[model samples]
Every structure is written in C-alpha cells, then in structure tokens.
Target: MKTLQSTTFKAIADDTRLRVVNLFVTSREPLCVCEIVDALRLPQYQVSKHLTILKNAGLIIVEKDGTWGYHYLNENNPLNKMLFTFLKKYLVGEVFDDDIKRLEMRLLLREEGRCVVGFVDEKDLLIKIKEKKQELLVKE
Candidate 1:
C-alpha cells in the first residue's frame, strides 16, 4: 500500500491535480469528466490523463452511466484516509470560493441518472457558465 500512497501523493503534487481534488472534495457530488475539464479550465486530454492517474492510485472512482463517466471520491480508498487526515491537520482555513461553489451547484443540478450534452438538456445550462469560468481563468 506504500506504492499506492506514494503514487497518489505524486499525482496530487501538481497544482492542477490538487485543485481537482479540492473541487471534488468541496462539491460532494459525482462529476462528469467534462465538468472537471471545464471547471479546471484544462484541456480535455490533460484532465483525462490526470484523472487516470488518480483512479489508478485508488484515490477516485468512475461510474459510467452510458457514455458519460462520473468521477467521485472513493470513501473506501486507502488514500482517502491519508488525505482526510492531512486536510484535518493542515487545511483548516480553506474555503471553496463562490465561483467553485457555483460550479458545483450547477453540476449537481445537471445530474439526471446519466450524462447528457449540455445543449440537450435545459438543466445543463450550467455548461455555458462553466465555459465562462474557463475563459476567466485563462486570462489570469
């Protein structure tokens, strides 16, 4: 399990990966791959690659309902024990800002047992909003 712990830590070592983890932790909802990519303002391939690493390290799990794959925190994952302990001891003053919270709530509202393209569902309107966030982040 040391290998797993090491791998998870390495995967989360990058700012992007750390942000992704924080997003997942604060959202408290199963998130689609596209949602993660959009929220993080990352290229689709980059997001997918990092997600694969996290999954391999046993830090996250993916659930596929049709073509949409939703990723969520793995409570039973051994890495989570370490992550939670670390957060409890060190991340006390952290908060999910308004933008992140808004993104999370929008994603939550889009869930309907399966993933659908944003244009296909009225509830998926949040996709446009997420895109705006990407634009803003890129400018920074």
Candidate 2:
C-alpha cells in the first residue's frame, strides 16, 4: 500500500540508494546481498539498511533460497521499471563506472549461476577480479 510516487522518489534520493538501484537495474540476474555489499564497497550492514529502504518503497524485491536472498528490481510495477530505465540511461560517472566494474568482476566468482563466495574483502576481491580479467584476456 506504500506505492506512493513520493515514496519511490524519497527512497531513491540518496546517492547510495541510486547506486543500489543501478545494480538491480542493469544486472542480468538477481544479486545476493553480499554481491551488492562488495560492489558498493560498503559494509554489509549499510547495504542491508539501504536495501530495507528500497524494499519498503516497493522498488525492489528479495526472494530467499536456502540461506541466501536474491534481490531484483520490482518490474511488476510500471513505475519501478520506469525508474530503472532512467537509471540505466542517465546514471553516469566514475563512481557509477566503478560500481559496475566491481559488480561485473564479482559476478565472475559465481558458480553455476549462483554466488558461491560470500563477503570477500575489498582488496582481495579487486585482486581476484584483476586476475580473472587477465585469464579471460589470455584465453582470447
């Protein structure tokens, strides 16, 4: 019942929330909370806090599978989809670029389309991403 237009606007007003939205907006598959935490380079608590706000605003939904919860944008609502379209088109800059880069790299750690590694430290995650990129480059 809280699908008020103002609710969505308020939820997305924070820069961090926008970055979270960007992840769900652009991702091909639902993301684990750990993935979002790694991508945003923030603590799990902060990411979870933001996720709670987004969920309350009805812009995203989370589905639990075993011990993990996969989150995706709420495309069921036209407004939610419209907001994501705008984020995809207009969210730009180094911060946004870095977020996407980290996420795409983190995704490489997935096993059989599911996140197997949880809560990697920032430095190790970056190094792994770089190494993975190098491996892909060598193969090509």
Pick the lDDT winner.
2
**Over the stretch 1-140, how does candidate 2's per-residue lDDT look in tens digits?**
75488888999899999998888777757999999999999989999999999998888889998888898888898877777888898888888889998898889888678887788887798787677678778989
Instruction: Report the error of model 1 at residue 17, Å.
Output: 0.9
Best by TM-score: 2
Clashes (backbone N, CA, C under 3 Å), per candidate, total 0, 0
TM-score, per-candidate, Cα-based = 0.68, 0.86
lDDT accuracy of residue 60 in candidate 2: 82
Q: 59 in model 1: Cα distance from truth in Å?
A: 0.4
Local error of candidate 1 at residue 125 (angstroms): 5.9
Query: How does candidate 1 fare on TM-score?
Result: 0.68
Candidate 1 lDDT by residue in tens digits, 3-38: 766776787887666767776776666777777765
What is the Cα root-mean-square deviation between model 2 and the actual structure? 3.3
The collision pairs in model 1 are: none
Determine which window of 10 residues in candidate 2 has minimal summed lDDT.
Answer: 126-135
